[model samples]
Target: MINSFEVKETNEMIEKENLDVRTITMGISLLDCIDSDLDKLNENIYNKITRLAKNLVKVGNDIERSYGIPIVNKRISVTPIALVGGSACKTVEDFASIAKTLDQAAKDVGVNLIGGYSAIVSKGMTPAEELLIKSIPLALHTTERVCSSVNVGSTKVGINMDAVKLLGNIILEVANNSKDNDSAECMKLVVFCNAPDDNPFMAGAFHGVTEADAIINVGVSGPGVVKKALESVRGESFEVLCETIKKTAFKVTRVGQLVAKEASKALDIPFGIVDLSLAPTPAVGDSVADILCEIGLEYAGAPGTTAALALLNDQVKKGGIMASSYVGGLSGAFIPVSEDQGMINAVEAGAITIEKLEAMTCVCSVGLDMIAIPGDTKASTISGIIADEMAIGMINQKTTAARLIPAIGKKVGDKVEFGGLFGYAPVMPVNNYSCENFINRGGRIPAPVHSFKN
Candidate 1:
C-alpha cells in the first residue's frame, strides 16, 4: 500500500524530524550449528553467523545511502545459545567460549552488536541454562559487543523466582566487574518477561527457534516526527490527538517496511516482520518523553504520565499495524532513561522515581530500561524489582524487560557517563528496605488463574 511519496514530504520528515530505521537486523538461526563437542559447536556457530550475515553491513549501508535515510545499526540475533550449547557445554568457561565466538563474528562482519547469548528459564532452568546464566557476568565482561538476555517469566508459565534471584546477583557481579567503565557491561544485558521472538532491538533480541534459517527484521523510530506532528494539533481533543499520532506512526512504519523489503531482497533472505517500536536516541528532538510532554503532561513521570503513555502506545500499534501486515516484535514506545534526553532530564529533576517508572512500564513496551541505580543497592532488592515487573507482564500478557545499571562507586545524584547513544544517567535512589526474605523464597510463582483459558 506504500506508493511513491512526494519528494517534499519525504525530505521534510527526514531532514526536519528524526525519522530513520533504527536497525536492520539479520536473524540467523544457529540451531543446526549445534554440536556435542564444545570446540566444534563454537566453530560451527561462528561459521554459520559469518556466512549468513556476510553482506549485512554493506547492505544496510547501501540502503541508507540509496534511500537517503539513516540506518543506525546493523546487527545479528542468532538462536538462543542455551539450547544450542546445552549438549556440548558443561562449565562456565565453555559458555564464555561461545560468547567469545559471537563477539568475534560480530566484529568480523562489522556489525555493532550480536544478541542471543541468552537463556529462556521461564518454566525452569536446566543444568545447561543454569551454567549459561551463571557465565553471563564473565561472558558479558569479556566480550565487547555480545549482548545477553534471560527470560524469567511468561503468561503461560509462571515466574521463575530462582532465575530472577540469580539474575539479580549476576547483574551486581557484572556491574562490579565493569565498574571502571560505569558498569558498561550491564548495559549489554537484559531481563525479560514475555520476551518477544522477532525483536530487532539489542540486549533483548534473539532468533526464536520457530523462525526460518535467516531473515531480515527492521526497527523503525520517529519520536521527533511524532512530536512535530503533535505541535500542529496543539490544544486538540484526545480524539484529534490520537488520530494525529496514528497517522504519523503509519508513515513512519511504512518507511521501515520499505527498508525491510529492500534489505531482504538484497540479501536473498526471507523478509521478517518490521518492528514498529518508537526507539529513542540521546538526540534532543528524538525522544518518547518529549511526545508524552507534548500530550499535555508537564514531565515524563508526572501524575498522568501512565495514562498518556497508554494512549501513545495503543495508538502507535493501531497505526503501525495498518502500514505493515507483518508487524511483530516489541512494537511500541521505549523509555530507556539513558537513551532519551527528556527521560534523563526528568531523572535529574525530581519528577521520576524507580517506582514511577515501574507504573509507567505497565503501559510502555519495555519495563525499567537503562535505569542507573546506586552501587550499594542490594541484590535482593533488584530481584524484588524484577519480580514486580515480571508479575505485571504475566498478568497483562505483554512483553516487559529490565536493563538496570548498578552504578558502582556512585550513589543517588551522581552521574554515570556512557557517552554516545547510551547517553548519561544520574544514579537514581532506591528504597533501602530489604527484600531478602521474599527473594530467598526461591520457587516458581504459579501462573495467574486467567492463563487457563484453554
Candidate 2:
C-alpha cells in the first residue's frame, strides 16, 4: 500500500488542485451536563465543552503538520440545546444565555465554530423546544461562533407546517438582527428536512443522543480535483466520464481516510465517518459548477444541470463507499451559490435564478444553500419555499436543507460580501407573488403513503 507513485499523485493534488480536509469536527454529547438549575446548567455546559475539546485544535494542527494535509478548520458539535436545556431553560432568555456559554467554550478551545444550538421539532415541539426556536435570532445575534439549526420534517414523522411557518419569521428576525453584517447571521442558521445524526459540517450539525459521548468526524472536500479529472477526459463517452469521476473520487476519499485514521489515533477519540463531499470555496477553479461545466454545460443552470448533478452525486457516493467503510454525512457535491465562484458568476451572468436553483437541489447535496435574496421578500414566501424543499426531501428520503440570507435593505443587482469561506452572493430575485393564504394554514403535512414500510 505504500507506493511512491501514489504519494506523488496525492502531493500534486494538494499542491495544485486545492485538495484538503474541510473540517475535523469533534462531536461531544452534552446530555450528561444537563441540570435543572439555570446557572448550574450553563456552567456545566461550558465546563464540559472546554475540558473535552481543549486539545482539538492542537491535534488538528499536529496532524496537518505531520502529514502535510491541509485541514481547513477544527469544529465541535454537541447535543441539541433544546434537549440539553429543557430542564433548566424556562424562558427564551435562558436558552439565549446557553448560546453565550457555548460561544465562550469554543473561544477557549480555539475551534473555528461550535454547532448544536438547535431543536428537532420534526413533527411537534415541546414548550422548551419552542422557546429554543424562538431564541435562535437572539442567540445567534449575541454569539460569535455558535451555529444553529432546526429539523422540521422527516420521512417518518412528516412536515411540521407550524414549525415551518414559525421558522420563516424567525429567519427574518435573524436577518434583521445582523443587518449591519450583511445579515451574515442568517448564514449561521439552517432549516433542514431529514437531518442526519452525525453531520460534521456547520449550521446543521448536532450530536445525536444515539451517538457515543465523544467522537471524531472529518469532512473532506475536493471539487477542484474532480473538475481537473473531468478535464482529462474531455469529449469522452458518458461511460468514460463516469469512470474517471469514480476513480478520482476514490483517490480523494482515500486521502480523507488517512487523515481521519491519524486524527482518531492521536486524539484517542473513536473515529466517526469521513464525509467525502465536493464542498467548494470562493477560491478560483474550486467549484462544483466548474465540474458541471467540464461535464458539458455552458453554466451551472444549463439545460442538463440536474442530470449532470445527479450523475456526479451518484458516482461520488459509489467511489467514496469503496474507499471508506464509514462513509456518511452529506457525502456528495455541494452547490452553494456564494461559496462557489462559478455559481456566483452564473448568477451575475443571468444564467441562474432562484427557481432554477430550487430545481437543482433535487439532485445536489443541499437545498438552496448560501443564497442571498432581497429583504422585501415576504416571510410567507420563504415558508412556502421551505415547504417545497421539505416535500422533496420527505418524499425522496434524502437530506435537504435551506440556508437563505435575506440581505437587509439589499435588492436584486446588489451584492453582499461576506468574505472568507462564507463568500459573497448577488441578491437574486425572489417571486413577489403572495403565498400568505397557503403558509397561514398551521398544520402538519402527513407523511407519504410509502413511509409505511416496515
Task: Estimate, for each residue in 1-454, the C-alpha lDDT of model 2 and write its tens digit.
Answer: 7599989998899999999999999999999998999899999998989988999999899988887889999999999999999999888899999999999999999999999999999999999999999999999999999999999999988999999999999999999998988999999999999998889999788898888999989999999999999998999999999999999999999998998898888889999999998999999979999999999999989999999999999999999999999998889999899999999999999999989988888887878899999987789988988898898899889999999999999999999999999899999998888989988989899999888995
Model 2 TM-score relative to the real fold: 0.99
Best by lDDT: 1
Q: 243, model 1: CA deviation in Å?
A: 0.6
Per-residue lDDT of 80-111 in model 1, one digit per residue for the tens? 99999999998999999999999999999999
- Candidate 2, position 142, lDDT: 92
> How far off is residue 82 in model 2, in Å?
0.2
Give the poorly placed runs of model 1, Cα more than 4 Å off: 1-5
* Residue pairs with clashing backbones, model 1: none
